[model samples]
Target: MTRRPIFNRRRFLGTAALGGAALASPAYLRRAYAQSGGEVNIWTYNNFVPEDFQKQFQDETGIKVNVRLVDDQGKQFNLLAAEQPNPTVDIMTVAGHRFLQFVDSDLLAPLDTDRLTNWGNINPTFSESDWATVRGNKWGAPILSGMEVLSYNTDYVSAEEAQTWDTLFSEQYSGQTAYIIQDMMSIVMLMMGYDGNMVEYLDDPDTAARIVEEAKQFLIEKKPLVRKYYDSGAEVQQMFVNQDIVLGHSWNGPAAALITDGFPLGMAIPQEGSYGFVYTFNIANNAPNMDNAYTFIDAVLASPEIGAAMTRASGFISTYKDASQHLNDLERKATSFPDEQLANLQFFRAEANELKYGLVDPAVEAIKAA
Candidate 1:
């Protein structure tokens, strides 16, 4: 959280229902999508929507908000692909790194930004990136932005040893370390002193493939040091609860949640830098309720009123430029980071093709089996 808290950098602001359009404004977007009170089906991660937003949206627009919760990004991607012939959901939540696969497969619709008056409220880092836009058309509306970090039981590991990732492989912590598969692919590259996006090498297939292969072999060799290749945040937290892991690589949200609830834990952005992710809204291909999709996205972008509430529920920060204005000092600290560290925050890159991404799962699986 801000590399460390800077109490004076931000102040607490009361969340008194400023409910307006995006930019946390005193305005509203057109409500044409509410005609006949249609439904907008959304497939999203758990705890992503603020309760009040859901209640207020239905009350004000008469449109029914149907949410289908999804637990994993990979599974969500496959479900979308399988249903492509007759897509069921109107809008889906996706991570920046994974958006490309959806777009490449023709599973998403180009965003109708012209109708989204609040599209300008997005942070440039998200709105301008190649990941969020393609062929000069915006395809995703970024909602949450966060990065992964190395976390440890503060009572067992000193901050000094936790400053870098080498401790994760040290014999002293052997059989006490864990990491998510997808994350380690990029973070391990970071540990190798790669300050740029590792996937960017896909631009030169020869180099990218070689790099991936090397990383795969490296992970296989280190497999014995890892206690588990965790699949979810809850699983990692359970490891902490059972005293099964002394060190782990995890998303910032879960670790922050653990710390807030009085767990003896500490999360740090390692000195080698780390990868970041942004959760966003993408319209499904052939969505039946296209109008409703656009309207719902505007409401989400306009939801800085519950910025702090979202952080409490989901553990990630909003991408709205004025989000800091809504956060109290503590929330602000956990969401923002220092310039030096932020400079090295790399996001997963779009693969050269689906086959490129296809190689990733098996490589990770091979390490898991070994």
Candidate 2:
């Protein structure tokens, strides 16, 4: 599930366990009516709200769509925070890692499944995710599935070289390597076998401090080899296009986009392993057009055709189970995610393990300065 699909089976049982259980996040058993009209102001990735579907939705339901593009979830959180008690946005995309942070910041409203008709069609892996469920309320609706992996210019890197994280830090790729400053640190820690329990080990301040320090120093030492610590997939894509990075740590979406564009890009999950993530739509707490947001969410989930367009456009897998069935042979190849990835993949933790982010961010800044 190796003709392997990018995501062919259920994932996130461990993730769901982290939340105690999936009381509110699972595909709802009850059906609900979908409302229409007015407007839904959404902040999502470009191409996520596909144009053809938008046109059809408006034509059929009279709901006006206003989409504000977002590239980084951290910035998206800040934008919502600045607006405070009255955010101008209606629905915004949130990653699993940032969902708890958003909820803790009081930026999102818990979803009411009675309002989303297609909620039942979502795969349990995404629908029952830990990110959106708190207590008994669900704050996010799953839309896209993604992962963290290594991608390289196939023209430059051999498949054997792409399988190990060591290649990124090796002298062979010096002055030609890149990675995002976020979770990539933890991946490095894991790759180094520093702590099998790295994320949860932060429960003890001393232990977490030591681990963070070690990770920081390692990254600092390796800084010269990196061309950039990029902020977005587009940056990595451009770096590849510009012949700037021979190999880079990237999200599956960006690598898929590169493949679709006919780049000789090769993707690997790294033998040491990586993490998988899901992107969901979180309604702003004080959204002015709440009903329209629900209407739009349902419309998107209800159609596999639109889901197919979205997957083709964004390179992320559709959370709707039937969506990929619509992809053609070429698209299937471009968006292919090997089924064997399940062996080394784990779901990422949300709530950011505060001690980790707190230590890592400053260290990264120091690395950038040095």
Measured against the true structure, the TM-scores of the candidates, in listed sequence, are 0.83, 0.86
**Which tens-of-lDDT digit does each residue in 38-57 have in candidate 1?**
88999987657765667667
Q: How do the residues 117-227 of candidate 2 rate in per-residue lDDT, one tens digit apiece?
A: 679878887788665587688888888888888898877788889888899989988999899866677787777675523566756768777877777788888888888
Looking at candidate 2, what is the lDDT of residue 174?
A: 94
lDDT of 2 at 92: 94
| Candidate 2 clashing pairs, residues 3+ apart or interchain | 4-339, 6-337
Best-matching candidate per lDDT:
2
**Which parts of model 1 have CA positions greater than 4 angstroms off?**
1-36, 193-200, 203-206, 351-356
Judged by whole-model lDDT over C-alpha atoms, candidate 2 comes out at 0.75
> Local error of candidate 1 at 299, Å?
1.2
